[model samples]
Target: MTGKSQIADRIAARGASRSAAAAAVDAVLGEITSALAAGERVTLTGFGTFEAAGRAARTARNPRTGEALEVSATTVARFHPGATLRARVAGGSGEPLGAVPDLGSLQGLTASEPTPVETPVPAATSSVKAKSPGGATGKAAAAAKAKAKAKKADVKKRADAAKKADAKKRADAKKAQKKADAKKSSSKSKGKGKKK
Candidate 1:
């Protein structure tokens, strides 16, 4: 949750003015951005790499409507932290990170405070992710099964109603036909009796 202002605060704690710290933060971000924009990789030895990668155009789907979507080809930036930065962030190796600013401040650590242990961020979207192999998470699968069951129920209900309606219509037609036949027979009988 820490942003540029927070980062500036840490640098300010190091005796630089707030404005100077802010300017330094902006300058570093700007240089990294410019390098990535020019399709170059900016690697700070013990920090991380900032690079741009091209993505191919592809078709994707809208989950709710099950509709297809067109995704245009584009370039995207990616960052892969280096071993030293990773180690320090993970609280591994009690040795200090060489030349890097106090990572502690970024982690809300003041010099008086010890480095806090943190859980690593997951790389995937957790909603559909598995907790472990063959285990625990089935939210997406359960949702799909429920949706299919509801759809089948809806179709069966409509079909049953249609069949009942058709049966009722045929019975009404048959009754009308029987009534007409009775009327014709009665009229014939009356005509024959009158002629006699």
Candidate 2:
């Protein structure tokens, strides 16, 4: 039946025996496995890298009895395709296998590229302000209050002064009227004695 050995012969080309091609493929696989076991990456030209990665410990459940189970942490193999392989799969360049695609004008576009932006920072703590505390706005309000108070005091003083002046004028006019009445009475008495 057709198997891996036949596939290898087809890849290796003319004059390569099935056993020899299989041995070559085994050698390459063995090398990759060994490197991964040693915590090293095995890179294949135009293919990809074979890496060892850790799987974290987790709790799993059994389906049969609904029982909880613990899955231990372990290392696993991971394969990543190379740039040429990715480009070919993506229908980039029409070039043959093992060749990098020419992405004219967009070559360097990548997720890792840096971009510039501005971030705002709050004002410093040392510059903290208690708004309207004994400042110009407060001073203006106090001055207005004091001016209103002074105006009331001045109005009261002027009213009291005018009352005192009016009382003094009434007293002087009453004294003058009493002296005129006294002079008229004395003249009438002198004229009556002469008639007798």
How big is the positional error of residue 147 in model 2, measured in Å on the Cα after superposition?
99
Model 1 stretches astray by more than 4 angstroms: 92-196
True-structure Cα RMSD, model 1: 15.5
Top lDDT model: 1
| lDDT of each residue in 74-110, candidate 2, tens digit only | 9999999998788787976533233223323232233
Cα displacement (angstroms), candidate 2, residue 136, comes to 91
Could you tell me how far off, in angstroms, the CA of residue 73 lies in candidate 2 after the best superposition?
1.0
State the lDDT of candidate 1 residue by residue for 1-196, as single tens digits.
2345555655665555556665666666767777788899999998888899999999999999999999999999999999888978898654322334543434432233322222233433332443222222245556667989999999999999999999999999999999999999999999999999
List the RMSD of every prediction in angstroms. 15.5, 35.3
Q: Please report the TM-score between candidate 2 and the true structure.
A: 0.41
lDDT of 2: 0.61
TM-score of each: 0.48, 0.41
Error of 1 at 21 (Å): 0.4
Clashes of 1: 0
